[model samples]
Target chain A: MTRASRLYRSSLLVAFAALALTAGCGKKQAAPPPPPPPPPPPPAKPTVTLQAAPTTIEKGGSVTLSWSSTNATALVIQPAIGNVAPEGSTKVSPDATTTYTITATGPGGSIDATASVNVTQPPPPPPPPPQPTLEELFARDVHDAYFDFNKADIREDAKAALSKDADFIKAHAGIKVVIEGHCDERGSTEYNMALGDRRAAAVKKYLSSLGVPADSLTTVSYGKEKPSCTESTEDCWQKNRRGHPVLAK
Target chain B: MIRQPRTPRIALKLHWFFAALLLAASPALAQDWFRTGTGLGVERPRVAVADLVPRAPEATAHGKLFTEVVRGDLDFSGILELVSPSFHPLQSPGMPLQLNYKAWSDAPASAQMVAFGNLQESSSEAAIEAWLYDVRNPSSPPVVAKVYRGAPTDAQIRKFAHQFADEIIGKLSGGLPGVASTQIAFISNRTGSKELWVMDYDGANQHALTALRTISLMPRWSPDTSRIAFACYIQAFGILSPQICMFSLELGRPVTFPRFHGSNSAPAWSPDGSQLMFSSSMSGYPEIYSIDANGSHFKRLTFSAGDSASTSPAWNPKTGQSAAFISDRGGFPQLYLMNSDGTNIRKMDLPDMGYVIDPAWSPNGQLLAFSWRRPNGNFDIYVMDVTSHQIAEITRDAGRNERPSWAPDGRHIVFESTRGGSRQIWVMLADGSHAHALTQSGANESPNWSPR
Candidate 1:
């Protein structure tokens, strides 16, 4: 029975095959079947462009951030500004050197773009200069005048110094100074005392002539007791014989 | 001429003559060193001072002290030459009766005169029997026979020694007295403060005369030696100012003085001690001012204007008619003479140009001794004949010898010198011989001799 069924199936296949061949020969050649449809053009990649207008800004200054994306379904900004619209610009102020990142997400994939803004600060300034004290000012302004040996009279060369001392006394209002007359060690203490008085008086007289009041200037004689310079030389003696002005304590 | 024999008649006559001379004790003789009188012009006497004999065993130390002091005084008498003690006899004379004249008058011990004494002492009192003899003429009476009895302390013993020495010096030198008992007034910082101090002429018995606790300088003894006037830094108008201050040696106290407004210093006393002359800048310039000793009368002597200063006046002790002061009126500090009332001012110019200051009139009113700084030398003490203008430098190459003060004897001078490495009080003969330091403990300056 199996053999008889197999023989009948074979005779049917032969009859259908002969009928398909007789149909292909009777019509024009059928067109080739269309190729399978290509992938929907890869859903255009989500192209992104990010920029910071005024890329360099000072600290505490604002900067504009602009970004554009093609074929992007959602757009977001990082570093404090999240969920932003695509193809739009926004203002951002970064405290310190910062990098702003923009992310775009679409059916194709995700993209990230960054823009860095440099913030600069100026150097600290130096402290203001300290003010000079009153005594210091007086010392800088006042001067001393020297005398010849054994003579208390003002010398021609000492006139300029005495004039400047007078100006200093006059320039400072309400300031008092003591003009100390000094002498060299060549003379006795008693005689030098008198000579020192004369030297100091000479200075006071010059100052008075220059408009400084006598009350504002006092006189003292150190004589040979207080030598400004101590040596046995003539130069040292010249240095010791002077009319020295001191600020009143 | 033949030497006289030791006859009894000649011996009796010489005894009365020598005895009369010993009793006279006359300083009125014309041979005084300070008097500028007619001098004896004799050769300096060669004398020997024997070690005092101690009557008691406990008086041995005091006896030696007395002997040494008498020897020193006689040696310093300026008119006497001392015989070396090495040539003295080994034995001390027990008394005049026991003296060995031949041993003293011999060649090795060639002493024309001899001083011998015995010191007797108890625990608290002492008696000194001193005698000066002419050993060549053994029969002559003693030149000086003195008995001094006092407390047995060192001071009293020293006093007795001075008395005995003075007696011998006066008799032998024909009237010049020894300066052993005089004092020197000066500025000393020995008590941690510059105060007025006084010491014996021989630099003993030093003591302070003030407790001002402030600086005092340039002490000037009054003519009477009873008070001292000096520049003292006293509080005036809330400042330590140099002003004239007085101290009395008798009362041992500070005398009040008028406080001026400016520098007042370097006081000088009149010959009669009636007034004090000083320099004051109260009138805007330093000028001479005269005030009464009682601090009442005030008179300005000098009227130098502008920068001219006249100060440091020394009155003519003999005449009292003129004064010598220092002035810078002619550029340098030079000596100037003026009447007591500030008239007839004249500059004392020298042959050479130099600084002359600290003019001190001599006791004779003939010479002026001052500190002069020559153009080519250091400050030295120079004596000038005021009339002839002849200057003689007494100090040379001795490290700034200055501030010369004539002793009452006028033959010795006391001054400040740096020869010993620091400022010290130094005494020397007026001819700049025999310089000796009187102060070595502290920095001493400006020594003023006492009038006595």
Candidate 2:
């Protein structure tokens, strides 16, 4: 072979070898870059579950919220009703029937479940008719004049009863009443009479508040006289400690 | 005169025996045999008046009618003396007319009194008849006083007799009436309740008038016996409200007057009964207020600071302008007097008495009856002369005696006490004599005597 032809053949062989080596290096570098990007993403799975808890609590009524996926650490619940409970075991009071969503998460991934309940109200009964009697009306007035234990001034119950009495007075314009105050037999006659007077005045004031004419009601204290039942019992005492409306001649 | 009759010896002997028996029964023969002569030259036989009258086993504590009447008659005549039957015994039984003069003359008394009566428990008034005699002058007719007091209890008979003695004393002293036939109205808490009760001035014939379930306090009577006014609390608006209510005893019903907004108590009626003055808190604190009989117009009489609560008002009937009341203006309660229109207010200086309340004017306006509380926390009824302001305590050891009221005749005062562990009514003489309990039940207070 000629010396120039031999040199051409060697140069071609060298160029072919350099091209094969560059191709092998490019293939190894591409495989390592993809594996590093995937490893960092696994830590972000916990955050995904935390973000999902608020959505689960939408239209909240009685509900308990929880989160777990943010970290492999223990789950935390805030503003606990009683004390810390197992995950997904917390109960809330005054539960209303409504749709509820529960969220669960782990280091691997997150998931949510939804439940629903129906709400309804029962119907009410009808009101009773009014029955009018002198004694009954007086009793209603007396019941409204005083408060229960440790209470000064009239209570709501008394006011309600007085309202009815006032309505009756307004309806019957010609009927004038004398409010006779009475007390239980536990105290002195003079003291009881004074107490009775206070009771009668209170009734008159309530009746006036309910639009009854003040002139139509005269207040007097009978003290302990005229007990409806002459006995010494709690029930009798309660009955005696009252005011009575009598028709004025 | 001489009589002679001849008879056989046997018949003559029988006649002599009969004549001797007749002689033994003769008054002159019996008296001559019983008479005895003293060493001082045949001293006259003394007599005891008690021996001339029938008596119980023992003389009553205050003396019996016969003993008292004889003593009174002898004391009035100033010419006779009496000796106790225990020392000089003389037995004369049955009625006064049946008395043996000879037997009574032998007693150590010169005069005697005889009394007879039937004591009944069912009635308060008693009927008694008494006579006075002089043993030295057997021919002189006996003096008698017939007393018909309604029924008197056994406990009261002694008092009744004392009253008769008083009458005899008055007759001897030339003119004072006996302490009898007087009635007292007082507050009683008997019947398990407080009520106004009336009894004989000597503490008998007690009957309650007020029918109150609560405490009936401070009872005052109108000038006429027809009505009464008292302070009581009536239930009003579930609270006890004090009031001054009038009760017409004849009508048998109670009518309450218009009470001021606050406490209306301690009522005192005007002499004419046309108006009533009372203590009220209508102006935020207790003050004196007067209201007409119809309760139409209420006039506030006083205005003072410091919760000047006025209580127990009294009006002078004669002057019709002066009034007295209890005022707490000086940090403690004291008695104060003022004009009827609330003018000329003055404090009464009552030394040693811490509190004074419930003033009642005597009918004659000469004195005032009131309750004075001592520093030791005890209360007693007292009477003070208006002119001299001389105070006299009427009750002692009577726990919480209060609300003294003068009787219409001004001879007695009624008040309330807690002496028996419960409030009761009591009566005593104007001079603090013969005090007795009038009420037996409930808690009674504030007694006011009836004007009549």
**How does each model score on lDDT?**
0.81, 0.58
Per-residue lDDT over B1-452 for candidate 2, one digit per residue giving the tens place of the 0 to 100 score? 12233235425543554454234222233222122212212322233445323233333322354355444433322211335556443454435566666555553433343333322223334444555454445686654454535435444555555565555433422332333444565666567766666665545566777777776666667776677777766764434556778888898778767755655776777878788888765454457888887787889888877434566678886677889987767655678899988899999877553667667887778678777776665767777767766666667786677767776545557777777777777776565655667767565555666554
Taking the tens digit of each residue's C-alpha lDDT, what string does model 1 give over B189-257? Answer: 888888889888878788888888878889999999989999998777645668999988888997888
Q: Provide the TM-score of chain B versus the true chain B for each model in turn.
A: 0.89, 0.65
Give the DockQ (2 decimals) of all models: 0.52, 0.05
Model 1, docking class? medium
Best by TM-score: 1
Residue range A94-211, candidate 2, lDDT tens digits: 2344444444345655444444433333344466667767666655553334433211245676677777777877887877877766677543333344345556667777788788
TM-score of chain B of 1: 0.89
Off by over 4 Å in 1: A1-133, A155-157, B1-41, B189-193, B211-214
